[model samples]
Target: MSVVEVREDGPVSIISINRPDRRNAINQQVALDLQSAFAAFDASGQRVAVLTGAGEDAFSAGADFTDLPELWRCIPTVGITTDKPIIAAVTGWCIGGALVAVMACDLCVASESAKFSYPEARLGFTGGMIAGLAARIPHKVAMEVMLLGATLDARRAYEVGLVNRVVANGRQVEEAVAMARELAESAPLVLGTIKRFVTESIMPKGPSELMGRATRELGAVRESEDGREGMRAAREKRKPVYKGR
Candidate 1:
């Protein structure tokens, strides 16, 4: 079965991460499928895209630990500035690299049960969350999130401008689709132009540069002593004894 599912809803395209059994954690295959889904949405006539996870448990739990090193390398974490608008329909635990995916979207509509976090510090990896989330939330909030591995519930996330909407539990996808449909009513060219202008104004580096930076930073993390320890601990179902190396 496909790890990611892409469906058309009139002018809106819905792309869902379909690994509910794994709390939607992204592995290499899932990463490739997700990229393909977004590529199709961008190339198609779909005016808006809504990204979600299959189950109510999680939008994504982060990268699967079985092959932690390959997760970041294969996952599409940086330089995705799509001309067409994309919305995130988040619920449950959206943690670690999952924060990057959510923040990358133009808009996020989360359910009451949704919780956002960056726990990569514990995993011996620096989540590229700062660059992705800082522009969307306050500097202090962003710092705390990455440094302290802080978690924010749906209401708190909305209050801090991390997400656009907080709907009742189980309504995340519905609300996001509704919002996308509303956006679809506007002229496509105008919407694309506005998105491009806003993106250009905010992004500090070009997509290519950002991608290169992400790869280098993550590569360093993968080679760290703590990185191997973290992965081993995860596979062993125990706490990592981080030596801060």
Candidate 2:
């Protein structure tokens, strides 16, 4: 099975990071898989996506230190860009880098047992993307989490606007999927328009977020069929025919 799994239920695409043994921590492979998964979701007929961790001991225990996954690559707006809405189904522990993804999601449903903390400052390093949390929630609260490494339980996260709602332990995903189903039935074009306007116009983008977006765009072009065709044409001394994919 894939490190990250993607399945469809009508217009909703559910993507799960499947490393429960590691508390669903994101490793290098998992990051790449997640990046690819959302890219596919963006190109798919799915109107909404629910991002969750498989087997729910944790949404993720942050990055897997053994491989140090490129944490940015799996973050919602940062690594994966879609005009479609994406909801986070957070379960159990959401630590360190995991907060970045949860914060960036358009809507978040957290399990009551969930606990979110960002200890990167104490851990002596950070991806720095979490800085955007201040823009999403109150500045002081974001600062508290970042500077003091404070933890937020699901209820507190909702009160502070970090999460949209909180539900019982195993019902987080179910709740998120219910939300997704509602979104799925809405007008896709209108939803996409509003989401894009907020993401590109209303929300502020920090340096790391900007860089992540640029990197994601670049990576897309580099991995596209046209990029390969261009290289082949250059080697063959002929003009490349671009597919504009």
Candidate 3:
């Protein structure tokens, strides 16, 4: 069986880590499968996606140690980006590379049972390319998570803005799916445009360049029919039905 399972639920595509026996530890195959699943979701033009682990015990314990060298060799393949919005449903024990995976998503919804850590120090390694965490969390908190190798509970993560929401145990995926469904109901072009704008403007780049890109890209979405539909729906007090146009 595949270590990762991709399932589509209407406009929300779910990518699940299925190796519960290893606490959903990522291996080379899992990385490839995850990349494939995200690519598929992007190609399908899905408005949103949910990434979660198969079992309740762990979202992921990080990369399979046995496959460390292989994983290191395939790091580029493991990091895939998509235009669609992704929501991470963190259940438990999110650590090391698993933490990076969750951070890569647009939003995160975690269970109360969830615990996040960067144990690279303990393992004689360092967290790699964690741009999102630095952007999302306060500097002090980010430093602590990195330096102490201590686990932060879901509530603490939410407080630090690392997690958007925290639900009861076993409810993470359901809540994340609901959130994804809500996002999917919006104008796709507008959503995608706004995501790009914010990501460029606020994260990882200078404001001037991001502003230019935002201004150039915003016009396309603004001129779309879905934009009009959004306005009309607002006036009508009904949900907008966007055809991704």
| Most accurate candidate by lDDT | 2
The per-model lDDT (C-alpha) reads 0.80, 0.91, 0.78
Clashing pairs in 1: none
- Per-residue alpha-carbon lDDT of candidate 3 for residues 1-245, written as tens digits (9 for 90 to 100): 98889888888888898999999998888877776677677788677989899999999988888875233221221245465788899998998888877765789999999999888877787535443466668987887888887689999999989899999999998999999999988889888887777665656632433343354357558878999999999999999999999
Report lDDT (Cα) of residue 8, candidate 1. Answer: 86
Residue 133 lDDT, candidate 1, scale 0-100: 71
lDDT of 2 by residue, 55-157 (tens): 7689999899999988789988888889999999998999987889888899999999999999999989988899999998899999999999999999999
Each model's Cα RMSD: 12.0, 1.6, 12.9
Work out the TM-score per prediction. Answer: 0.80, 0.94, 0.78
Error of 2 at 85 (Å): 1.0
Off by over 4 Å in 3: 69-78, 205-245
Which is the better candidate, 1 or 3, if ranked by TM-score?
A: 1
